[model samples]
Target: MKRSHIPPLLDRKWLAPLLITSSLSLLLFLSFSLINAKFPPPASGFSGGGSSSELPRLPRLAYLITGTKDDGARVKRLLQAVYHPRNYYLIHLDLEAPEGERLELARYVKSEGVVREFGNVMVIGDADLVTAQGPTMIASTLHAIAVLLKRAKDWDWFINLSASDYPLVPQDDLLHIFSYLPRDLNFLEHSGDLGYKEVERARPIIIDPGLYHLKKSGVFYAKERRSLPASFKLFMGSAWVVLTKPFLEFCVWGWDNLPRTLLMYYTNFLSSPEGYFHTVVCNHKDYQNTTINHDLRYSRWDNPPKQHPITLTMEHLDDMVRSGAPFARKFEKDDPVLNRIDKELLMRLDGRFTPGAWCMGSSRAGKDPCLVSGSPIVVKPTLSSRRLEKLIANLLDPETFRGKQCK
Candidate 1:
């Protein structure tokens, strides 16, 4: 309609070429901007053009540290040992803990200088009822996983621990070694053989009071027992595990109905925590091949295995180290071995966090190196990393990794 008002420039032969050039220029600029936004420059210290081998992006771990009545102190201690600026933590004190203790734990988390600065640690405002032998325990773990999935965005792995569990190496060592690993792999000790568990655990129908009652009480066994599930094969292993975000997302989101279905089936199964995840992971084709079949925890059991693992003491230190496990459990409060581990392995002071590259402050005059924060992506692996590397190597060995799955 404006043809009558066309200027001499529009009539020129160069006008068409100029318009095409301008359109292409605008489109190219937008395309470049999107590419830049999608992949920003690496952190300051990192090198290379996107290969993880040249400069791996440090991995972050999300820990669910749970406790009961008299476990606040131990939970706090465990927090200090595993705390890092780059990672996220969720602390849960069960309903058994008094209100004062819960408040104290929340206050402690809020008061810590580094925690306040990074804003990474969280104490659940409401506690979950957890009965270890019943489905409620598994429910609590899933609840924590769901919360972590919603609250945090960058964690690579999710590890569940109790107040009694302690790390054998500093967070830096684990982070450094894990940076090289594939993010999809999951570390858990699982087997398809249910032998004795089939009778003692799977067949027993029990109801956990924690699931419904406000006050915690023992689970009651029902007169009727259910048969083994026909839809899915049962698997059993250690309750402790190191899992992945994608797998846990599958567990929590339930886009595929398998997780929800199995969860309902295990609601009456005794010791559901040991089998729920194991069964779900093994039955799914996408996740089955990703299993590492190692819990990465050190524990000593009696000859025939008792109700619980033996409490660790100084005598088990060498064995714990030699096993190349990253964590161990069932330590009494204020165990001497904890002090030894703090001093020798973690290089941590009594109240300070485990020392790592991020801790740039002075430690020369008994000051906490973690007082000052540095680049979070930098990792300084120590001798402990060598043991972990070996452990990973053996577990991932072609013959070993494939043979240990589902079966």
Candidate 2:
């Protein structure tokens, strides 16, 4: 092809300037792109090219749901109640449960078409023996966390629950509200008030046989007691937690020795689950400010409380809702209250997943809308979200948030 004609005088001066300007602009753009890629904006605020009112990316929750013998059905029920395509779930039936129970759970997980499609749920084949009040519980939780961190790289928070626990709100409500929150916030009930725990828990030395044994057994206390730690203050609270991914990584990877040190220390501590994460988060300067002293679970303890909270019943239904807690514990297997929750709060029916924005199918004649899946990021929150929002607001308030930290 013949070259197009150009004015010689115009070409000589303008072409060189134009080329230089364009080349300079390209170099500047690439440099800025590299910088942006290397060090993106902080997760707290909006990055470039988005409206200020636009919400942040939705969070993915990693759940560790544990149970014992005869809890396989309950575990499946709990999983259905909280199922969301965006989140990851690891079902762990401890070694106390029979191998058949574990296999049944695995088979059920495999059978669910939606769960199979999403590939977010797993059953632990090699289960851990988790003594309720022992360090083995903590070990099981941490193991689940490690598995989640390895398998699902994008989950934002880790939550531990038992088959006895159930959600008070839909997963959409939780995910929607959490989309507006800072990813670093760790929701753990913590207090340094050693009160009776000093005598009952901290000073006691116990051995968890579950750690070294194939069969489950209670933790036995030594005849002699030990003095409290001078190196770190003891903090204790509810074992149930909603922890940030970064904090869990710190615990699992143990870049700093504090987590490992506390792990070893808590190995012999009674009810270690209640104190291990609390003490670790409180003692670490990086995580202390991130603590939001609440486990986001509602339970009715008896007068002078017992080992476990009272089994939640229909009588506690009104209180459970009003508490604005996302979860409640110690419900009896197949309780009527759970059915009520399914009918009311969750709008879930028998043998169906809780309906959410991601569920695209029709819902006439008591059908599951979640039969057809949609984008997981599409969060259409319900009125239940307002309750969670209120709870979170109160927790984040100056009087409760900072004032209650590590205290």
Candidate 3:
């Protein structure tokens, strides 16, 4: 080949291509950073372990803070109350929320100095279909657990919370006590639908569109009803639960295949959330003994019973604290009782981070003092921790603890 014709391109073209490739690589890197900055992980919760001689070493929690249509602010409040550096968080907004709300929630997560620093929180880019009373609720929870497991191997517990729910005790109080608990224990309420089958819920069949559809819609019913499962006993309880990582993994992996089958069978079952965790825990041999028979929430149902549980108000403050439950649910948005709880129970004010032993800043009068974020450890259990300590003690007494297993 002649020098002039020998692809003059090979002579200097190599440098141009190299420069172009380098520039593209740099641009790609910067674009990724900006995308991450804008959409940051949908994280809205935190976790850490506290001491519980009655329970094992305190375990790290992986929280899934999920919300639907217009829940951005509620999720933000939930995340702040529960945030901790020692655990993992995955925030999820259902497909119903507008793009603006999703982006707004993401912006809030990224703007937090602590959230950006820890980098343990994440947002679900593709939100799941979550119906109010469908098996999809269970599916969504399992999906979160699967994602958390895939992302980090350190969390010991998996807690699910809604935008409507709030924590009564600080994470530090909960962590301090949970540290002394067995890692395999599961907390859920159980009534077993025993004599209650005649009631509408146990006998009826319903379908949730959230598992399949995009727009928000109520669960549907089928005329051709089916009988209950003969293979497994049916148990029912509160939708909210505090599940151990082991149990959640079992539900997701289901080496025995029960989890998947129940998921399918419950597709038509009414209020599946009330039964999914209950049935799974009751039937699993390895995990049945770990069931704690309590939902760890202070939910008050009406005297004769109503579709929705009674809402907590300022009047319920004393009952809430005496209940010994660490969390409560179904409060109105920005209720005055929330302020009372923050002032009296959490010592949180001014919409700042809740101060804990990990927060080294000293407070005066009513100022929020979490500005100085110190070592993430060093839990300071308060009188609230003592209340929880006593409550957990009674629950774990050998007579009650062993006797209540899977009953």
lDDT, each prediction: 0.78, 0.79, 0.70
What TM-score against the true fold does each predicted structure earn? Answer: 0.87, 0.87, 0.83
Q: Considering summed lDDT, which 10 consecutive residues are worst modelled in model 2?
A: 10-19
Off by over 4 Å in 1: 1-53
The most accurate candidate by TM-score is: 1
RMSD of each: 15.0, 15.2, 14.7
**What would you estimate as the lDDT of candidate 2?**
0.79
TM-score of 2: 0.87
- For residue 78, model 1's alpha carbon misses the true position, in angstroms, by 0.3
RMSD in angstroms between candidate 1 and the native structure over all alpha carbons: 15.0
Give per-residue lDDT, candidate 1, residue 322.
88
